[model samples]
Structures are given as C-alpha cells and as structure tokens.
Target: MSNIIAIDSDIDRLARKLEHEARLFAARSRNAEAPRSRSWIVVDLEFLFDRSRYEAYSIAEGKDAEEKIRWPFHQVAAVCWMKMEFVRGEPVPMIEGPFVLAAGEMNERAMVSALFATLENNPDAIVTTWGGEARDLAVLRRAAATLDLQLPHQLIDGSPYARERLDLCRATCVQADSVHLPEMAAAVSVPSKPSPSKKIGVLCEAGDWSAVRDQVLADVLTTSVLAVRHLAAHREIECHRADTMTAIADATLSAIPTSGFARKTFAPWARGEKAASQLRGVVYRAAA
Candidate 1:
C-alpha cells in the first residue's frame, strides 16, 4: 500500500521557504522603476476528486440529513493541474492540458518536485493567482509540506492587492458594473465556452475536469488583462481597486452554497486574511 502521510507538515515547510523567496522578490521589485511591466508568471491549481462516490452518508434525509453529516464530507483523492502563462501586460495563455493525480496515490514529493521544477526554470517571475493568496498558494504550500519540497517562486495574490492598490471596492463595487473573471471571459467571447461552474465537483461530475482546469487558467488570463488595464489607466490606484474587486468576487462566490462539505473543507483558504496581511507586510518591508 502507498504510504499516507500528514500533508500539513509539508505545507508548513513549503510556506516558510516561499515566504523567504517572496520577501527577496519583493525587495527586487521595489528597486525597479515605477509602473513596472504588467507581465507576471502565474500558477493556477484545480483539485479533482469523486464527490458522489466518496461523500459520507447520513441516516437523516434532505436538509435535516445534511445537517447531521459533517462538513467536508468527502475526502480528496486526486487533483487535476496546469500552469499559467507569464508575460508583461498581456493575457497569458493557459497552458494546454492538465496533469492528473489519481486518488489515494498522489506522490506528494513528486508533485512538489514538478511544481518547483516549473518555478526554478522561470526565475524572477511574480506568481499571480485569483484567490491565490488564500487558496492556490496555501494549497501548494500545504502540498509542499506534505511532500517535503521547497517552493519555486515569489508569490502575489492579485485579487486582494488589486482591491487595495486600486480602491476598487469604494470606487467600483457594483456587481453589474465590473465584470467577474468568468464574466470577463464571456464578455471577450472566447471561441471556447467557459466551464459551467468554477467548482471542482461540478466540473468533475460533468466529465469536464480538464476543461474546467483550463477555464480557471483562462480566468487568470482575464485577471492579467484587468490588472494591466487598471495599471495603465490608473497607475496609482490599481492595487487598491484590484484588492476590492477580489474581495467582492470572493464574497459573491462564497455565498453560492453548492456543497456544504466542500465549503467547510476549504474554510482555511477562504479565511486567509492573516496570511494576506502577513504578505502585505512582507511586501512593504521588502519595498523599504
């Protein structure tokens, strides 16, 4: 049988290493000219697992039944993954295809090695993500801890930073006004249809896990577009606006109530203010 080790420990170690690298990167960025290139490297993560099959059953029925069941009822068995495009002030391409990790057999070490390999090859890159500050980055950090691997790049959670840097919430918080990542993709009217939902379970059920993963990457591309446009148009206000936009988006997504268990399972990622605050401090210090 494959060895089953606690993943949190690995995540702890990876977080430390990443924190170190992020500080270093922020320092370098501070010394660079203002209105820095919009180009950035991003890593997007999508986890896949069988929900209906693995979800725990309860004796009760309907809403009452669900109430009896524990939150995060399903255990994650595998993950579907991909890498994002890195460039300045342009929509980065979502790398084609995905790497699939089978349930109950993910080699944590191998996964971390692969992630680091990707990062090492792209030195001096600013890692970007939608909710990456809270979700994607933290998940990878945990995975690295589980695998005992060092992380590859400097991290930036574009969503929150964008809001804070650009004052988006106060200036542009209308739901109907600003387009969402998914909505932005639709507005652009990409030839391919956007995935049905961003939820991993929903995509897996539709047998479109790969497509969903790609959509997530595409969303990152949208983020890049918005990031650059905001920067170019309102160079002094982009970060605050982006952070507000991110906050708004997150609040909307969190209210969907698709899978109670999934909601609970991802609680930590959702509650990443602490980490985000810490990162912001690091950035400020690095800048100093």
Candidate 2:
C-alpha cells in the first residue's frame, strides 16, 4: 500500500497509463449520437481514487480540484448498475448489483468483465448516466487496460452520441446552479445520497456492503429519473410532431419535467396570456 503513494511509482504510472488507454478506447468509437427515441437505460457507478496520506495537507492548504486530481493512487473500490426500460414503460430502476469490485486490491479484470457484459447484454439501450463518460465507463476502459483484458466489443465502436451512452450531466442546463447529483435530486424532492465520499472508504474497509449498495442504487435511480425528465423536456421543446412528443412523454416521463422545461416553455406561455387593465382614457396630455 505504501508503494501506491510514492511519487512516480508503479501505481501512479499504471493509473495514468490506464487512463490514457481509456481515452484511446473512447477515440475509437464512431461519430454518432444517441437518438431521442424514448427508450434508454440509466446507469451509475462509485469508485475510489487518489487516496493518499497527502490528502490532509492538500485539503488544509485549500488545494483546488485540479491539484487534488493529480494525487497518487487510483483504484475502483465498488461498482453498481441500474437498468431502465423506457420502451417497456418501467418507471422505476432495476439495478442488478453493487458488488465489491476491490476485495483486497482492486479487481480490475473481474469488474470490467461484469460491467462490459451488462452493456453488451443490452445492445439496444441508450445508455444514460451522470458523469459516466469521464468517470465510470472511462474508468472501466482504464481498468481493462491495467488488467490487459480486451474491452467489450460494443464499447469500442460507438461514441457517446452513438446510441450507446448518454451522459445526463452534460445534457441538463441549469445556469442558476451547477447540477450535481444531489442538487438534481433535491430539485425533484427525491432523497439525497446517504454516505458521503469521505466515509465510503471507511465503510468499504469495514465490509458494509449494504450501505454501499444503497448509495449506488439511490444514485442510479436519481440519474434514471433525471435522464428521463431531461429527455422529455428536450422532446417537448424540440419536437414538432404530436405523436413523437406523446410517445416520448409516455416512455420517459411520469410528469412533465419542470426545472428547466417550465422556465423555457411555461414561462413563455404564461407571459403570453397575462391580463392587464386596458385603460381607455388617454390622459389628456397637459401641455408640459
């Protein structure tokens, strides 16, 4: 474990190498975007990275995000997946597993295998997630490289837009505030994540799998709901055809998304019909 924290050590080299590999894997995909067809899957994952004794000093000195990211050590601690069937009219998420990916050390090969298998099994899905491209899915590619395992066949072919993956974090527009997962859930009145980032490693060390499972599932559900809602809003605003809008509403939405949608559409509609007294008496302008 001490070796992991050493500067320019094997762990550091391997992590950065794997991350670079992940980037290469992404670059191999086709230039296509996910279609807004009211059918999709929402997924989320949680992992550990940049754990070092130096974190305390970094925090004490108020180090910025970029500085923090450069810390040595990277590992995938745990992973989870949630499947959404928009076409089938499933409103709730059906998350399969939040298994411990790192038993003693990070089980890079096995975790990647499971995640790849999940995506491959659902080839027809529009993979929706929050920060997945940069964090979760990308990390899998890196982990696969670290293990020298082949990436899933489907992953190497299509870009984020290729009906393969849809990252909701990049989709929703909230100029009023940045849309973090907790913030998005709060806007919808959904429950926030129970365990914080600092405590996750502690929990993992203590073998609290249930807590890990619950948090991952909560995040997945939140991502699923937000993804569906955001898609519906775009459809409502962008689509001209009534059939398409209705079909989308049926599949991706339970109620219309009001966060950005209302501000964009409803505000305009409300302004159009606002009543004011039509005073007829033009005040005889006293020659001033």
- Estimated TM-score per prediction? 0.42, 0.54
Tell me model 2's lDDT, rounded to 2 decimals. 0.53
Give the poorly placed runs of model 2, Cα more than 4 Å off: 1-39, 50-72, 88-106, 157-162, 174-177, 236-288
Winning candidate number (TM-score)? 2
Put down candidate 2 lDDT per residue, 202-231, tens digits, no spaces: 776576656665566556545655665676
Superposed by TM-score, candidate 2 places the C-alpha of residue 65 at a distance from the truth, in angstroms, of: 14
Among all windows of ten consecutive residues in candidate 1, which has the lowest summed lDDT? 163-172
Backbone collision tally, model 2: 4
